[model samples]
Target: MAFFDDLSHIGFSTKDFYKSTELYEKLGFELIDQEDNLGSKVNFYQINDLILEVYEDKTNSENGAINHFAIATDEIDKTFAHVKKLGFELIDDKIMHLPFFEHGISYFNFYGPNHETIEVCQKNKE
Candidate 1:
């Protein structure tokens, strides 16, 4: 079966985490999940079924407005292998488990030729 399921969320890079998050809140979006890894912070907000993922960035050299877009998959290992076979180098190739979640979320982000990042993830589901 094809590993990919659906589009999970789209990520944006922001220098000011609280400022941007507040802006989203004013737009009727509410914080659903957030995680701080290393020095980087990732946040997920949702309005109805739409999800927007944002991350803190100290240095964003790219002019692109998008940081990365996530694709959901049921079989993350197979999906990761497929992306590897396509010759895309993965920046995140390990399991990332959050304290609030049960299963570990496995994912990888690869830079396209244009330097835009794309992520395929298998979310922790019961």
Candidate 2:
């Protein structure tokens, strides 16, 4: 089945939230949303259909980088099944909603063979 319909957003782990926010802003992205997540600040930016989500790295470690990207899907159940059939390891098989957004978003993450985190999600129609 065709699972992912489009690229939703890219997630990034950064040492400085405001600094990273400024960088993306310099690149022509505007801040669209922000929320507290896991003791870190989650910032979402947008430039048309392209989006970037940056969250502070709690450990402030050297691992700060592009963490993951979420793909928009209409059929969450079928996507999960197909991703599993392809042998990707599920991180959490549960659908999660973002409290920051007024509209609903249901998604789950799975790790590729190389451990790259990817998300398949059903986001509200705009």
Candidate with maximal lDDT: 2
Clash totals for all candidate models: 0, 0
Query: Per-residue lDDT for 7-109 in model 2, tens only?
Result: 8877767766666665556535689998998678999988779787788775655444545666667887777777767655689877667744557777888
Q: What is the TM-score of each candidate against the true structure?
A: 0.47, 0.48
- lDDT, candidates in the order shown: 0.68, 0.70
Stretches of candidate 2 off by over 4 Å are: 67-126
Q: What is the lDDT of residue 89 in candidate 2?
A: 62
Which candidate wins on TM-score?
Answer: 2
lDDT of 1 at 90: 66
Q: Could you give the C-alpha RMSD of every candidate to the true structure, in order shown?
A: 13.4, 12.9
TM-score (C-alpha) between model 2 and the true structure: 0.48
